[model samples]
Target chain A: MFDDKFLPQFEQIAGYIHDGGAVAIQQILHAGRYGGIDLGYCVQPSVVPQTLPHFRQPREVSKEQIKAMITQHAEAAKRAIKAGFDGTEITSFMGYLLANFNSKFTNRRTDEYGGSVENRGRFMRELIYAIKEAQGDDHPLIVRLNGAELMDAHGGNTEDECFELMKMAGDAGVDMISVTVGWQEAPESSIGRDIPPGHWNRLAVRAKQLLPNIPIAFGVRLPNPVMANQNIADGEFDYWEVCRPLLAEPELLHKAAEDRLDEAKHCLGCMNCLSRLFRDLPYLCTNNPTLGHEVEPEYHITPAVVKKKVMIIGAGPSGIECAIAATKRGHDVTIYEKSNSIGGSLVGYAAYDMANKEDLRSQISYYKTMLDKLGIKVNLNTDVNPKLMRSILHQYDVAVVAAGAGVDTRGLPIPEQEGVLVTAADVAGGKVKVGQKVVVLGGGKIGLTLAEGLSQTGREVTVVEKEKRIAGDVIPTWKWRHTSWVEQLKIKTLTLSKPIKIGASGVTIVNEKGEETFLQADTVIAASPRRPNQELFQEFEFMVDELHGIGDALVPRGLLQAIHEGYRLGVRI
Target chain B: MVSTADEMFLDTEGWQAILDRRQEIFTDMLPGASLGILPKKNFDSPVGTMLTWVRQADRMEVAYQSFTGFENTSVDLLMVVDDETLEYLHSQAQDNAFNEMKEQIRNGNVLLYVMKTLDELLDLGYEELIEVLKIPVLGACR
Candidate 1:
């Protein structure tokens, strides 16, 4: 309910809030033109996505205009205060205009609010003090501030800034500061990437070090409570702001309290929750269907009408989810996974990022729990063929296929030298060995992640993307790390470079100018691009009968698409 | 990721169909409308265009949409107002910040923005928002 489509809905809800509960108005001036992309998305991106070198909001903000914006902010606050909101959370994280004004990287103008750190922080500082005075101290004022965005491009903001802002807000009669990262253009990297688990803790610890008494909420992507509690145990952050995960599984807190954490089915950080933010789609979870369904429980979760027999084949995300839902509906269930372990491709992809892998494993545990609760039997390491399916067809009322797609390792058409090509899965599985000097041909997510790992391993790596920028489809936060891996590894990136030939010596490439050049490498990885081996056709009968096929089995795609299909199929079936 | 079609002419099942099929998705938005969806006539290729690298999408719920203060009939507008980054980046390729995006937009590799309201068009200081409807659709994979 954050877009234009929500305004009418807002008024209707605003009427209800006014009728009873209080409402707090949080307005973020996402300045898209300041530093990089001026991405209307990032409150204030490091580099405006659209660079207007000559255009600067600070320089353009005349005293009168500044007064106008401030007055507007105050008026909105005053209106909300009048509308019965207990207080407001001044959102500055994700580098909004106020946040950008605080960022030295984004603000570079010869104006009162653009030079020193104090000047850069003036807007957020002024707004807090102004609104605090307007609403009075102890009115429950909160500022969502960033300790760091984790992006190199967005000239990092640190715990020092958080501590400074805490004191300033205290002086200005502010109440709390919720700390977050990923404010810059590259979101995942803003806080932490999918690599190294609990990466944001260090930054959070730095903030707490400076402001011991102030409350700080950590906004990293946590798929489950174990990770959240672990972070709290580490004392890196004081509060855990469950936004996306909450969208993924709204019953998280309740489920955790009931000792049913696995049943909660954590968020995958696929960025779908925020996707709906663009169109007012309920912040959704690829696993949990009940999210954002406060009004209608039927749409999310339906209670069982009567116990029935159910059978599921191909135990990937979709298979597990189906088993869970069916068992919850009082049906006796059985699961068939071709792999030895219950987690299919996830077992391989689980190694992608520690935190993300943990999330995936946590969901896997949920499948185990739900299946066990419903007395669902699982036949592991047994492939489900048509004959086996027919033999059991009389025993089960419904059949679900989670059988995943085939793993496609399309070799490079170019000549291969020793140790030059590897499947993305093999790379993630740590099978691919990168030599001292490396060149990754494919620049997709796997290629990028693999490239990052190789670069982090301290190899001289060069990433040749057939496309312009690598990892274009990763979430903002992760996107940051994906690219940073390239920078942090000091990997040489050749965009708009096409690979014409590959050999043991290295790779032959034509740059954007179409000039042929050979990149010398000790080894070459041909993961430049690959396809999924969706097995939907094999499950055609199951889909026709029980109505679903999920994961790579159906589309032969990545986790994002696979998980989405799995969850949606859960509802349809 | 680039995909080729076979069953329905796609490497991945019609991702466009999957995306387009979300109209019935029950979510927070009561009547979720896909803004990036464009008329088939808008594209040179029937297949959807890919907007891989551009960043940040601003989701705005229009409080009001009017021309000279006269209101439009439909619910104001649910628009994803892109900052002039694409336009700005397209205009300045030589500049350091735009070196990456300039090549994409020029080559016609653009994710189209659906202009639902009159102000969305006017906000860009352009004559017609309706005309820009002939662009690529804006969306996310998951």
Candidate 2:
């Protein structure tokens, strides 16, 4: 609810973002039973208690209270118009006030605003009509409603009932309909990467069939623009409602339009943004570092005052990102890759899963396309050492060392068992032959991912970790998916286990409480404790005037840090 | 580094051709609308001098300025320098630039046109620009 007290803040935002051409829209909502418990009381259509412990129970609202609620919605819409917004959208999803009234799960009132589909939808209908009357019918109003509550067993509305509610809202003079799925209490992952792109299009298609005249904005785990366009072209939905994808890559539409779909940083479907929002923190993209700092001038890419010839060693994510950013700043960049191809760890990791492989491969393809387009010279199979660097000393003004990491077997105290033990990198890289019963030495992300991949190939995989948990290094948002995959694949994970000796036949492990066990394995793959390869960078530190170290060359970290470091260095240099 | 047409470092004629192509596209697409062409500042290159020549060229209400940064001002259309310039435009556009321009276009205020090179503009004809403009301006404002 907006009032004159909030006008100053709204005006300040409007003025601050007044880049001379903006159509700011205000969204109004009432939490009802979902309102803060600290407020002392909450009102709902009926006396419904929240399943979650943190949420408070709400008292039933009387008929007079319902009239007051409708009046409040109308007043909020009028305030939004006065606050300089082009229009206002009434939020009736995600277990909000209006959504609670419309949902059969929360609404048990025998009054006109409850019971049948029409009665359950009456509150929303009245709210929309009241808002339109308070402002004007031509005020570009929109109604945001859930296509499916995803709470089928919890007395939520069905797809048919939701479509009927949409028709009701459309008939009430809403300019457009925004379709979303799931609620706060839904027992499903609706917007995660696990859900394939355009998975919720059937909901939108049904809405279009029901309300053919009203425009539909479809969203809920749809990230691909190609698929979005195809759906629109096929008339499944009028608008592809994108939010998280835009957060991941701000220039998604622009890059798609320029035929640089690969160049566009696709949303990895890592729910880091959603995770942050759930914790009441500002959302950030795992891949794009400039996401939340849009207003900062430092994040804004500006043309370099002076262009220099830059030499980046290694063709990993960090190296490629540095090359791209530096080249974009008009610098002449040449990447010297020790391997024959690009995407150092990414190339190996892409082979771990079918869906993930496609996503990572697209990114690698984008890097290749961008490198080609920017005229960046990539020297493959050309490892840069001191002697080789001295030969090309005059060629580059600045040198960036991103030589990446090396596998260290120190974590596993097993004796050197030649020809029996292999690194997880080797197994993931498909360089080494894996046996039928393979024991992965570590339970980090690499180990778990490799285990999942190995299990897919019908190999009996066992991950032994000295630590208590597996995939500890994985991003929190994606940890569940990895754990679920490991579970589904039936990959055995032995925690609190230490390798004592590595024989030709199997490895001897000492578990907690002084228990010793022989985990028979045909082959052991070491996946943990990677040390940084800072030799080249350290050797050339004094030789060049401008020398920098980034990515795994500085320290063995994940892709988020590597890419961010590359981008930071690229912009700074 | 590998050499390409864009990396060749545009001379006076090359820059003039880019300016001419932009003027033609903007003039044709927005017909009788004021245009502002902002080229990235290259102190060591001849583009700065070439922009001076372009500013003096006989074009209808075309405002030319060399800026190292971005700013929003009064203009019917905005013409940028190169891919780097467009990349900057894309970065800013992420911060509600396109949405704002879409609103402006709907209200007959402004239009944003990005050209990587003179040839790219020529390759993307007026019809294509209209089609591209229609999406952000009319279709996908949200």
Q: Pick the candidate with the highest TM-score.
A: 2
lDDT of each residue in A483-541, candidate 2, tens digit only:
66776788988888878888887888888877888877888988886788888767898
Q: Candidate 1 at residue A492, lDDT?
A: 78
For this target, which candidate reaches the highest DockQ against the unseen true structure?
1
> What TM-score does candidate 1 reach?
0.61
Candidate 2: clashing pairs of residues? A21-B100
In model 2, the Cα lDDT at residue A264 comes to: 84
Displacement of residue B132 (Cα, Å) in model 1 is 28
Compose the digit string of candidate 1's lDDT tens values, residues A342-393.
7676665555552355656666677677767667788898877766766665
lDDT of 1 by residue, B57-116 (tens): 322121212221101112212222123433343233234322233233323333322223
lDDT of 2 by residue, B22-103 (tens): 4533444333333344343432233441122222224433224443321123332344344444333333422544333333
Error of 1 at A4 (Å): 16
lDDT of candidates 1 onward, in order: 0.54, 0.72
What is the lDDT for A210 in model 1?
68
lDDT of 1 at A3: 38
